[model samples]
Target: MSRTNIDIDDELVTMAMRLYNLRTKREAVNYALRQLVGDPMTLEEALAMKGVGWEGDLDAIKGGGPIEDLDDIDLDLLPQDLGDLDARDDR
Candidate 1:
């Protein structure tokens, strides 16, 4: 592999390390780069993933069942605050 020095965002690297649970900066960067542009699995490997003991009903989860009308929803039951995000002054 060719080694090169390049500038990268520290915050992004930290986030990637935490998200992927990688032990090193090299591992984190490699994982992130693979995710962005690499498909390490072959077609046979990808096709093999089907019916590999996954018990969940994929069709039901993909909206194959009957859909409910929005009017049927109770607005009062919804959570008031989505998250405690800081208000942006840029707005």
Candidate 2:
């Protein structure tokens, strides 16, 4: 992985560490980046989900979203669920 070093404000770093219970700055940064990698979004796309209930959306809670436009996540394919998957092809 390419390491791009950048300066972050101390206050911001402190807050991220506290919010995530992170022991090192690298851990906090990595956690946040990993959460963000699956769904890269402009700020505008996230605000659209402000009013939705959180009964079933972990991705939205972690990354914020409009939900409707998230095409990468397949909720129907949860591990315990077979849904329409072929019973013969053991996944």
- The candidate scoring highest on TM-score is 1
In terms of lDDT, the best-performing candidate is: 1
Off by over 4 Å in 1: 40-91
Off by over 4 Å in 2: 39-91
Measured with C-alpha atoms, the lDDT of residue 88 in candidate 1 is 39
lDDT of 1 by residue, 1-91 (tens): 8897889878878987786567888988877777669758657546756765555455544455454776654455554564545643423
* Clash totals for all candidate models: 0, 0
The 10 consecutive residues of candidate 1 with the worst lDDT sum are 82-91
Residue 39, candidate 1: how far off, in angstroms?
1.7
Predicted structure 1, TM vs. truth? 0.43
